[model samples]
Target: MLRDLAGAEWPRRAGLAALAAALGAENIRWVGGAVRDGLLGVAAHDVDCATTLRPEDVIAACKRAGLRTAPTGIEHGTVTVILKDGPVEVTTLRRDVATDGRRATIAFASDWSEDAARRDFTINALYAHPETLAIADYFGGLDDLREGRVRFIGDARQRIAEDHLRILRYYRFQTRFGAALDEAAETACADLAHTLKGLSRERIAAELLALLALPDPHPTIARMRERGVLGVILPEACPAQVAALARLIAAESAQGFAPDPIRRLAALLPPSPDVAETVAARLRLSKAQRTRLVNAAERTAHDSANAKALAYRLTPPLAIDRLLLEGADARGLDRWAVPQFPLKGGAIVARGVTAGPSVARLLQAVEARWVGEGFPQGERIEALLAEELAKRPQP
Candidate 1:
């Protein structure tokens, strides 16, 4: 299946330009999702090339072309060629020599069929020649991709057993393709769900985050729960809460916020202390994102007495918190964060004629005085500051 690149023209140019220089007589072919997506008439961005060249040869070729090449995964026969516009990942054909489920020892091979067979799923095994506009489907991946079926390439159990992380990936693929999985594939995943303990929390978190970040997460998680995957990964997600969160998420999915990772994660959190931190640590999220997400969850769980306390509880997302309060029977966002502290630390320092802790105390006194006065004019603040400043020691 070939057509002139029309809509997303830049990425098409990037792929073509990179392949033109790198694939120059090397017989390298575009492989994996890039090809599958192209075949499905979907615009693809991350273009990967399967090459006949060995890792060393790819390195040498890039050097010969004066291209910057990094050993992205040298042991796994992958090198990222840094081109002027786009980076193309050139990976030699490889098949697993032995797999311990967590890691595998692979050997580079020239047999495209052998390499394709060792891949995880049928749809991911398809390859295409960008220049000639030809496709190579050794395992009937074309048919499977077209049918929206996510089936393992050869043996389902054997494939997943090669890497336990694939167990989570199956549901992610289900979310993307919405493909009806084969019976044998479902059985294989269900059987291996218990073996997920062998996988590291870091790996589990990555796959789970990707699944939750999908446009529609409920179907994917529901599949995982049904297939016994979620129990092993996230049992704290109350079944009813999970469904409600998903429903709220889908309804709010259209607007109100960017697709920020922390926002998405806040929507997923259960009413439990340390769970957010544990999951965030497990996923290896950046310190900022983790803290923000934890704060969001904690704020959502709180029953603050007043507007100020509630506003303090929810640092940001004033609008979203308002909606959440309505949904959760809490004080409205306005009533919660209604009052404003007009005095600044600098103003307090200036008024007190002293720095350090005294400035803080003076500001606090000013705030209290302002609130006590029910928020008066500049005359009231000036009068209050004058009274508080007299109590501070002159510096």
Candidate 2:
């Protein structure tokens, strides 16, 4: 019984309105994330609806309404209807007919209750009538949402059996919503933790990154490690690093730093190139991400590297990642304050040097000294540049 949903305003959006008009107000309702977020007063990023109409019927209805439709996942009974405002995804009500702990073979169903029953979490199984704005809670999702509880709908073990990725998702949602874990859910997750191996690296990586994106996700991650769920997929993961991550996260919040999942992930692993590479391969991370992770590991391992020099060499983002991973005080790592090298190739050439490898070598030597002297300026930099020129062998 949700009241006054005008604050959500999503149901009034042109896309949803057109979708509702085409599918009939009673036959379609906002479902899944949109509905859950709406009831919680959080702005939803995507609007997904569940409808009694089948996929073909949905496409035809959208066409009749003069809305462009895309078969985003037609086999799965999902259509992306593009309206004046945005695209609203409408999925026909579905029930899992078979499952193998990783993938589910779903069959379209007309019964809302049957559709709700197949969902993983109660808090996510909510539905909202488009026009009336009345919420449909097939399970006790309303109570769970109000109480900050994350529970598997119906049976915990059965849900886990249906999809092992829910183990990671359980922690992710817990952290996101600030909800306490359901005891049965936790127990089921721990008992069936090995099933996570059957899941693809991409799924695990996506879920893990989402978990790390939450504010102060360290506590939940620590709990996952304790339950041996982290090790099930990332055997090389070091639980000890999460302690460092906790301190870094505190500093990040205090200094108004945005959340960084890659850096946070670095804090959870050992600082080894081989390990970083292996993890990247396992997770199928993009090339740029893999390079940054490996570079952070290598740079942080250099105990003698000055933080400023590191920032200059590895670029500020990579250097900061390294600094945080190695337990450097975030207060001291003012990367933006790192001074730029006062000399360039042109500066060296202006000092009576020809434009060749000789100029390049001279600039490299001077810049090395500048960085070595903590990026000196004025008289100090001039003196160093002069001395290097004198030693240039009169080219």
Candidate 3:
């Protein structure tokens, strides 16, 4: 009985109305996450539309309406309609002509059911007319969504064989929406777990992080471990690390810190910087991501360091990561702006220290003392500089 997209604010947006009028409302229907999340009464962030119009025609129609359009994925039959509210992805209806687990060969179609059949999950196949807001459930998606079930649209094995990343996507959806795992879907994912090796590491990393980013993913992660799916993409994560993730989640809750996928990822690895670096490289994490993962894995005695000192030594965010992982207090640094050291290298050189390596060493010593002494300023900085200068040999 899913009749209308009641809570979905996107359809009411003026830009969407303009786009619909320009393209003829009958040709387009809101599809995918927008429809699914709208049914669940959750606010949808991205609005995707499936249309009978071809890509070039979509571009032409938008231009005729004086609306900006981008060929964001024109080859894949998608056109981006840039509205003032946000960019809406308008994709022509497509059916997969062929799939090889890595990529798909698609063919444009006029049938909505054909397009829905090509999707991975039943809940994702729901569509809604833009004007009337009537929902179209092609594969019992509304029922499955109401029942809190995450099931593939067709045969789970056949759907997963088309895209190995769906295995990870299944677990991610199950973690977020399912009250109980669909036994058949679970079995299919487990049986085809080895196929994940054929997919790109970047794809694997993206899915893994998305799963970790869930509100409470440790239980699902433990499930992933039991199926041996986690080992294929992330061999560094051991069974023991699942418990560590649970602990990290609890710490994050207790400390009122937001759930961080990268930090949670750090919890799933052995507390070794070398292992973190290896995992980061294997997953193709960005440079900043690699650094954060490695820093979180460092086996430092975070409990011993005061909040300010830790923040000064290893940055506020990284320090917060270490403190939370160790189950220590991180509230002291909350909204506390880290003060800069008052002394500079030039200031040290002005104190008769040579402008070479000695000045650098003197600056480091003073900075350390300043950090150790709680980042004192004004006259206290002058005193620290004098003490460091006294230790240095007179030129």
Among all candidates shown, the one with the greatest lDDT: 3
User: Cα deviation in Å at residue 170, candidate 3?
Assistant: 0.7
Tens-place lDDT digits, model 2, residues 1-395: 44356678677787677778888999898888877777778888788889999999999988888889999999989999887777788899999999998888999999999999999889899888888888899899988888788888989999999999999888888888745667898899999999998989899999988888888898888888888888887777675777867876876776566788888887777778888999999999999989987976675456336777777787777777776666564445553776767677887778778899988888788888888778878899788888988986653
Each prediction's Cα lDDT score?
A: 0.70, 0.82, 0.89
Candidates 2 and 3 compared: the better one by TM-score is 3
State the weakest 10-residue window (summed lDDT) of model 1: 325-334
Segments in model 2 whose C-alpha atoms lie over 4 Å from true places:
1-4, 301-307, 327-357, 372-382, 392-395
Decoy 2 TM-score against native:
0.91
- Candidate 1 local lDDT, 1-395, one digit each (tens): 43332333333565456555765734687788777777667778777888888888888877776778889998899988877667778888998999999999998898989889888888888776666657788888777777788888888899888998888888888778746768898888889998888988878877877876777777666667777777887776656656755655644554333334455555566744488788777668788767665765555433433434445435435435434522443323433444566677877655435678767767777776675555676677788888877776665
- Model 3 TM-score on a 0 to 1 scale: 0.93
Better of 2 and 3 by lDDT: 3
lDDT by residue (181-282, candidate 3, tens digit) is 899999999999999999999999999999999999999999888899888888888988888899989999987888999999999998999999999999
lDDT of 1 at 195: 82
Top candidate when judged by TM-score against the true structure? 3
Residue pairs with backbone atoms closer than 3 Å in model 1 (clashes) = 307-336
Q: Is candidate 1 or candidate 3 better by lDDT?
A: 3
